[model samples]
Target: MSFDIVERSLNDGTPVELYTFTRSAQVFRYTSADEDVLYQGATFTAVPLSRPSFEQSQDPGRKPISLKASSGLGFVQQYIASPPTDSISLIIRRFHTEDNTTEAVISWMGRVTNVKFESNQVEIQCEPIFTSMKRPGLRRLYQTTCPHLLYGPECKFSKPTFQLDAAVNITGGTTLTAASIGGEADGFYTGGMVEWTNAGVIDKRFILTHTGSGITINLPFEGMVNGDSVRIFPGCDHVLSTCVDKFSNEVNYGGFPFIPTKNPFSGTPIF
Candidate 1:
């Protein structure tokens, strides 16, 4: 035999309704004075009232019963409704103020349409709207070592990569275009492609000013378009190198670069 139970705690003078199932052989338990009794589960039908409260007269269709308490109190009223089905619907409403003004009377409705008795789960559906606004420059974006937004000791990964898509604009300093976009895990400087002039390489920098916007540096690579994306691949044992800032200036490896060999068995071999 299996059963389900729902318990609600209320402050003094709060009105509530108790709905239950019939075949389950349920029970009602309450202890508190100054409590106004409404419907009792003596019979499997709706009970009549001489002078109904505001909540009772509102819902005349589903025939919901009510209980009103005066002082701080608690009560439990249990009764049987219908048998279990794949879905059930519940509606809830609220008032805006204590005066019960027609203009000030705000009501809300919510429904719990589904329940899984075996798993002790429920699904509630509702429609409500809320909004908020804020000024610019109030938010700062940071890329952390973990996808879970963890930092410092909590971050287990050795190196984390972050990419900026837009062309960073600065006011005063020179423009430092990256050979490749993205910052290293441990290095102070970010690496980017610089123009190879006959004399030497020219470095770029950016400095902010009150009158003008930031400076912009254009990259020379074909695929490295403006606003193009970049990614950081963290170091992993047997996967990524753990040298951290070791590759900051090193672009190509090995003094003598090796070229790929052609397939020897591609054409017919001479005897």
Candidate 2:
């Protein structure tokens, strides 16, 4: 029977939901059923997961949805303990169990925005993808510091060209000791980034400080230990001097180095 007909009938169908969460190359699938479900040749593991009612809006604004899951679930610890640097997108599908061949319809699509813990459940808040399209774009700022994001298209600089190879010799909470990290000046990599593979996933963190062979990161990767290989990249302070000397890309510098410090319009600024 067709899905619409079965869905409209009160006692003719058993409906189930499938939730898929994705980030970069990682994908997690869950099924709202007693046992695992196989659809489209992929397995969606059954979990204690439920979503509140969500609606589509005619207005050009954000329509968010929330997913509540059992805290005891192992996957719940990931969001609670350490949120990923990249955004995680979600796709929900609904189909009737009465017909195995019937295709599931997409019920909702969004990206996870925040996670909250309540007693024994975790609530994941998500915002619709359309909301991002409705937001304003970036505007150029009249400031001394370059407003272009590092490694972004506007910066016109290649990140891999300045990347360095290193290995962890020791690790503290959010600090790591690596001999290669000290190859340059103390603050050469202060605003730079570091990344390593953890459990087959690429984990990244920003350098908070760099001194000698010790460097602190904004966050520590789970299970990071000594002997792990890591990639480090040098940072730019966004100054014209640094751009010319360090990166040799002053031609693409985005800041005005000679902006007047003293305003001539001020009453005492005639000299």
Candidate 3:
């Protein structure tokens, strides 16, 4: 007797296509290359909402499903350690022999709301893409528009001129001193992206501000350790000056630098 479980395409010798998706960068959408990082062999479970006894007129809509899978060997550590922001999409395809054709079937397609990784397994909680549009609660007051540094419709700034990677030395306890990031230094790390290659996720972010060949940078709570592998991207304060100096795109500056700080509702300036 053959005991080997097989995942065969319904259409005779056809193949089944499986896809899992997650954002490569915290701010950017997934790219073709990001597809290379999707989790493998993820099992999906969708549960139907049970009807309430008291309500007869209302129909029990389809509820969100649960997807459980193992973090790929490359992404296990970061998936467990960092806060949840990674979004996931799952889709399955199978061929139908009777129809003489292949069709796509998706289990879950949405952002990851929660993730529990343990014992070499990862459990993910997700909602449909449309779920975010359903705002059942109150909205908050808008103070300012936070635009993406580059390539956002609001910002429209150009990409960075350079990319930097650094090795952390044991010297800087937690503050990330000058000596720790090699002999070379620059203040560009402030507002930059901090990514550790070994880390499966992105969480070592910071709004760095420093001195003496050191740029102050936002880092993880524990900061960097000896020989920690890290990469730094140039960050901007989003000012007219920085825009002109760094990216050379002052005309594309998003913020209103000339806007008065004093509240207009509170009357004119003291001067």
Candidate 4:
């Protein structure tokens, strides 16, 4: 029977919903059915997952959906402890059990926004893909300091060239000591970032302070241990001199450093 007829039939309908969450290279699939389901060559494990009725609005502003799942699940626990740096997306599909087929139609598609824990269950909130379009566009600012993000497209600087590779020699809570990275002057790496692998997952943290062979991170890396290799990148102070002396890329500097300090519109003595 066709999915349309099966879906509309009162007694002949058997339905299953599939939920797929993806973050970078990791993909987790789950099904609402009692048993595991295989659709499109991918296995969707049966899990204690449920979602309430969500409105299908015709207006541009859309409401978000919520997925409540057991926190006891391994995948749920991992995401709760340390959320991935990359954006995690969610795809929900419905399958008609009568024919074990779906028209490959996506019921809901969005990205994970927030996760909340209540008792033994986790509630994940997701916003529709078009919700981002409602956000206000960016407007450039007139400031003395560079407004462009480091290593961003406007900065026009390659991150790989400024990165340093080293292995952790000592671990102190949220701090790591790597003698190889100490060759650069103190504070050279402040405001930069560090990336390392932890328990087969790539973890990243911001550099809070850097002095000598010791560097403090903004967050304590979970399961980080000694001898773990890491890559550190240098940070920019966003000053005109630093742009010219350190990176030597003043051509791409986005700051107007020579702006007059005095109010030009006011009736005052000209410099």
RMSD of each: 24.1, 2.1, 9.8, 2.3
- Checking candidate 3 for backbone clashes, the offending pairs are 206-218, 208-216, 208-217, 209-216, 210-216
Top candidate (TM-score): 2
Off by over 4 Å in 2: 56-62, 269-271
Clashing pairs in 4: none
For model 2, residues 1-271, the per-residue Cα lDDT tens digits are 7878887898988899998988777788999988888888899999999877655557422578888898876555667657888788888888787865667888778898888889998898888777777765777778777777788887888999988888886566688887777788899888989988766678889998899988889987877778888888878889888888988887788988888898777888564
Q: Model 4, which residues run further than 4 Å from truth?
A: 59-61, 198-201, 265-271
Ranking by TM-score: 2, 4, 3, 1
lDDT of 3 by residue, 136-180 (tens): 564322333334445466566543445556565533433544354
lDDT for each of the candidates?
0.25, 0.82, 0.46, 0.82
Query: Cα lDDT of model 4 overall?
Result: 0.82
Give per-residue lDDT, candidate 3, residue 70.
48
**Using Cα atoms with residue i matched to residue i, what is each candidate's TM-score against the true structure?**
0.15, 0.92, 0.51, 0.91
Whole-model alpha-carbon lDDT for candidate 1: 0.25
lDDT of 3 at 248: 79
Cα lDDT of candidate 2 equals 0.82
- CA shift at 127, candidate 1, in angstroms? 22
The sequence of per-residue lDDT tens digits that candidate 1 reaches over residues 1-271 is 0011111223222433322221123222222212433332232122221113334444443333232322221111100121222122222222111112211112322222222222222222222211112235534333221122111242332333432333432222243233343342322232222222111212222221111222233322222334333322222211112223442311221122233344467794842
Please report the TM-score between candidate 4 and the true structure: 0.91
